[model samples]
Target chain A: MYALIKAEIFKLFRQGKTYYAIGALFSIEAIILLSAYFQGTNIIDLLLENLKQRFYFEGTLLNGNLLVYLILNTLWFHLPLILMIVVSGMLTAEYKDRTLQTIMLQPVSKWKFILSKYIVAIVFTLLVVLALALSSFGLSYFFFGKGDLVVYLNGLNFFDASDAYYRLRWSFVSGALSMVFFSVASLTIAILFKEAAKTWIVSAFFLILSNILLKVDFGDNWFNALFFAKLNDTWQYFFYYQINWEQIHFNSLLSIGYSLLFMGAGIYWFHRKDIG
Target chain B: MLFSQVLLGNVFAQPVDPDLLKLKSRLDSIQSFTTQLTLSVDISFINMPVKKAQMMYTKGQKVKFSSGDFVMLPKRGLDFSLNSLLEYDFITVDRGMEMQDGKNCKVINIIPTDKRADFSIATVWMDTRLRRLVASEINTKKDGSYTVHFQYNQDQKVLPDKVTVNFEIEKIRIPINFMGKDTDIDRKKMRAAGSKTGAIYLTMSNYQIKTLL
Candidate 1:
């Protein structure tokens, strides 16, 4: 199993699309960083325009911690989409390159090979998120400096510098799990469809549908229990003035469960799949 | 007392109340001051921790307020002296004597003669014995209104130990990007909210006051 995982990692790094994935996320960080630098203060002022008349605000709020948070907002759709496309290519490439047939001829079992792909999918997703973390934090602070964070959640919650840092760090950690789930789902879709374009389409549709349903409260408790889509926003719970740890735990565990469900479905199909 | 004060008003008194004169004179002698300030906010929309800042004030100049972290203070109540209300020429009408803060205080209503004044009416309850303001309220033309109460220390009676500033502000709308989709903002409360009231409780210590005398 360990040898199979090493071989998958070797193949993952060899692909040019992996670099494209990292490059795409970094490009997004640059746009966000530049946007924060130029227009962040104006946005902050416009939000507090009414309050400024009645009160005098001291110190600055447009800082590095805020830019990191702004980048985290992209987790809703942008980051996941880029991740799914790249991670799915890992499997669909095997079909296009005729590697799947050649690998099957070896003594290695199909279950172990597919499991190795799933593990590599998670590692690749995490690496993308880590790159996002480093560039967003390092560049934002270097350019914007540090100060208090003012967010409009719960009627304008103002967190001091240290508290903002704490919440944002945990948010990234939770958000990484969400990215991993999408990557795993991408691979499973590829296994089901067996084509690169179809996998990307289905995965993109899945992501969009998840976002739409996350906003709709069906007034039935069963909806949330059945769908793991809304659970992706577990990171946002940390920004509440009063943190609800239980919800974070439940939602995070549910995301992991969904990832396993996808991985299991992929393994089952690959074990029975015939490649001649 | 009201009848006699009204009778005495036209008979022998000057244009302004003696109480306002004494209160203004005692406060006017102070050239400058620097103090450590702690501000606690009490408002529906704002949630902030207690903020510590340095406050400096000199005669004929605006306050120089500074802090390492973000802090918010109400523009109306930070200065307990009501300098702006009293600086312009004003005539006072004494509304007899009332017991305020356990002192036999004189209730004086001041109407600014200068049209440049931001406030239309200023009411003060003064403890003329100590020459300190027990309570004051200013009704402004544009910035709504403010009511303030002061608590003084025995040794440093010149500056109040604590002040509570109550003010009213109109409802304000926030832009879309600032108020993302997930926040719990009650639209009903927002539209229904008229001029809402908020308070800022400020405590000052480590005073380095310079009085010109």
Candidate 2:
């Protein structure tokens, strides 16, 4: 199983598409950083416009921590699409190149072979998210310097620069967990469809449908139970002051359960099929 | 006759309204006060909970709000001390008596002589019998215009039992990008958006007026 995972990583690195995926992340980060440099103050002004009526806003409002928060919000809608692009082809490419039959003829079990691809896809998702965090912080820190972080969730929230580091760290970790869910779901589609384009389409549709479902008013009790709404708000749990531990634990368990369900279904389907 | 002329001269040369002086002296007598207040804010598109806070004020423009959470209050309303207005170098002219809340009150218009005062003009209506401020229209530099109405209990202190503050706030503009491609048309629509008025109702109780010399 270890050897199979090692070979999958090697194959992923050798492909030019993998480099393009990393390159695409950096490009998106660069665009967001530039946008922050040019218009970030306007965004802060809009958020704090109501507060400004009473309080005299002093000190730095645009800073590295704020930039990361803004980037996270902007990328949440697009990061899943990028992950889908990268992971959707993970299994389908093997089928496309007729390498599935070659790999299956080896002494490896079908479950181990498919699980290795899923593991590699998870690794790729983590690396992309890590790069996003690092590049966004590095570039924004260089441009804007460091100061208090301002978030507009549940009204105006101000985090001192000293406390921002840990909050941002946990926020990125939770954000990566969400990406893992997307990556595994895309892999499931890849295995089921056996066609890269169709997998991409279905995965993209899932992302859009989940976003639409998030907005639907199914009442509080029912809406909170919806997996997509939970997934969409996973990052908000890092707001320690407003954290609902029960919801966070519930969502985490549900996400893990769903990922296993998809992977298990994929493995069972692939195991039963005769690939020639 | 010479002593009588000196006494009359001393009284006439003061050139200040005796009623205005009486009102200022009464306001200045209360050096400091602390009150427990419940503030309710109502503005378009902004929902805020009724905040209960302990407010402390000293005579020298010092004010503080002690609350567990963030407290938003109009600065002028929070620091609404008549001492601050009377202590400044202002020209006070009697605007004649008027009926306020069915009581005949003295109207005084105060224009600050200080070039750098926060407010340009303040029109005050005072209940002379009670020596309490009935209402004031203050035109300030940063806050535009504010009209504060005071409803006082028949207590010895000048502080009101309940205060209603009415002020105009510029409409907070939502970002164009957030509104999508209809931003330009939406902006035009927002431009035509009428006056946005905000009012804060403060009920003051448990007053502990302390005179710190």
Candidate 3:
């Protein structure tokens, strides 16, 4: 199992597609940072325009914390798509190049082979998210500097520099859970389809449709129960001054359960199939 | 002897109404005050929790708010100072008696002599018995119209214990440009949607008033 996982990681690195995925995430962050460098203050001015009428807003509004928050907002939609692309290719590429038959004929167990792919996909997802966090923080901090963060979620919410630092960091950390779910789900689709194009199309459609469904008002609990909606809102948990441990625990459990269901189904289907 | 007595009585009665003079003196007695206030705001499209803050005000127009966390207070309503209104050159006219809150109050209109004053006209209802301003309607060029109602305690000082401000404001709409579309057009649509009338209820207590005389 260890050797299989090592070989999988080695194969992932050898492919230029893996670097492209990381590059894509970096490029998005770069564009946002550059835009912030030139027109960052304007964005802050626009958000604060209405509030300025009622309150005298002092201190730095455009800063590292705020820039990171904005970047996360953009990443919520784009990150899943990026993960789907990379993870879907993981298995489909094996099937496409007839490498799956070659690997299956070897003395390796099929479950271990599938598990290795899943584990590597999870690792890749984490790395991509880590890269996103580092670049966003590094670029924005370099350009905008550090200050308080202003959030208009339920209403106008302000966090001082120290509070902003911890909350923003944890938001990214919580957000990685959702990426892991997406990675596993994409892998499942790739195994089921066995064709890269079909897997990509189905996964992309699923993501886009779930996002649309998230906006539909289907009452309270029912709407929140949708995994994509829950995934998108995972970052909000970190905003609480006194963290709601019960709610966080519930959401984390739910996300892990969903990922397991996808993995279980994928493994069962792959094990029964006659690939040879 | 009869003519001289009539002349002396007329001289004693100044052109400024004695009631207005009493109200002015009552309002001027507090040179400064610091109060701890809890503000509850319910405006359209804005959800805010009860905010507690320390508010300090001087005889001049200097007002400041300090809180451990961020507090959002309406700029117009919270700065309630009769002195600030009276600072400008204005002509005070007696508008006769009117019943307010089941009490007979003397109504007076203050018309700004300077056209460039912040508010064009202010109509104040002063409680005759308490010698305190109970309600006021201020029409301004910039800020539209505002009506402030003051509820005072039975204490000797004339400062209000609570205030409710009713004002007309442009409706609050978050300007979202859908997919980088024209925001100006969307803003125009939002504007054409019309304005709203809102109120802020402020409960002020723990007053540390600096007695000016």
Candidate 4:
């Protein structure tokens, strides 16, 4: 298992797509930081237009914590899409190149072979998220400096610097879980399709469909809470003044269950897959 | 000072009432002063903890507010001197006596003679015994009406230790672009909550006054 995991990690690093994923995350961060620099004030002005008339605001609301949060919002679409493309390509590219057959020829356990891929995929997702966190925070603070964060959640939640940092840390933790699900699901899709281009299209469409479904209100709180797509946005719940630990915990556990379910399906399919 | 000039002159042609002059004179006595204050917002939609800020006020200049934390201050109410309210030429009519917050106070209605003034009219309830403004309602030309209630500690008669400012603010109709499942926003509720009559409570202490009469 250890050797198989080691080889998989080695393969991941050698893959050009992995480097592209890291580059994409940093490139997104740079664009966001620059956007936050020029247009962020206008956005803040619009958000506080009503309040600005009545009250004078002291201290900069557009700061490191706020920029990080804005960057974190990309988890809803961009981040996961990128994760899906890269992780799915990991499996599909192997199928295309016949590397899966070469690996199986080594007398490796089928469970370890596939599970190693799943573990590596999860690790890759976390690393991408971590790289995202580091770049977003480092650049935002370097450019915008430290101050309080004002968010338009539950009607204008203004958090001090310390509180904002705490919320941001947890948000990334939950956001990474959602991204892991995408990576696992994408790998499962590759296992099913056995083609890189076909897998990418299916995964992208799946993400968009899931996002669209996430917004469809069922009008029942229990139903809404239980919906798999709705669990994707669990990270955003932390910005609320009163944090909902139960919902976060439940959603986080549910996210893990969904990831494992996809991994299980991938393992099951890979176990029976016949090579030419 | 109310009724500063009758017609482009500095002095009023008629004798101004001493009571109205006393309110302005009481505030004008301090050359400048600084105080630490905690401001709490009481709007149903906005949620924030009390912010600690230092306010600096000079007689003829704009009030300056500074805080290490983010602070929201009512643009009109923080001017404790009532400088803006009484700056331009205005006439005071004795609206007679009224009981305000259980204190029998003299009601002075000030109608601004200068079109440049932000307020159309202001009604002040003066605590003649304490020689201070107990409460006042200022109707601005554009920013809506503001009602200020001042509470002074007996020991610190010059400045009110506490101030409650009530005003009507335009309801916030801005869309929240936040992402999350729990962020199911009811636009109907947001519309209902957008505009509201809110109050800002200011607790002032740690005074550093300079050059008092």
Ranking, TM-score, top scorer first: 4, 1, 3, 2
True contacts kept of 1: 0.70
lDDT of each: 0.82, 0.72, 0.74, 0.84
RMSD of each: 4.2, 7.9, 6.7, 2.4
* Candidate 2 lDDT tens digits, B72-122: 577566555665455455676889999876778899887777667778898
Runs in model 2 lying further than 4 Å from the true structure: A50-55, A222-224, A239-241, B1-90, B93-173, B176-213
DockQ of 4: 0.64
Provide the TM-score of chain A alone for each candidate, in the order shown.
0.96, 0.92, 0.94, 0.97
Best by TM-score: 4
Residues A26-52, candidate 2: write the lDDT tens digits: 777788778878988887777667557
Runs in model 4 deviating more than 4 A are: B1-10, B13-15, B175-184
Clash count per candidate? 0, 0, 0, 3
Give the per-residue lDDT of model 4 (tens digit) for A64-106.
Answer: 9889988988998899999999888888888899988888798
Model 1 steric clash pairs? none
Error of 1 at B41 (Å): 1.2
Tell me the DockQ of each model, to 2 decimals: 0.58, 0.10, 0.13, 0.64
Query: Rank by lDDT, descending?
Result: 4, 1, 3, 2
Worst 10 residues of 1 chain B by lDDT: B4-13
What local lDDT score does residue B161 receive in model 4, on the 0 to 100 scale?
A: 91
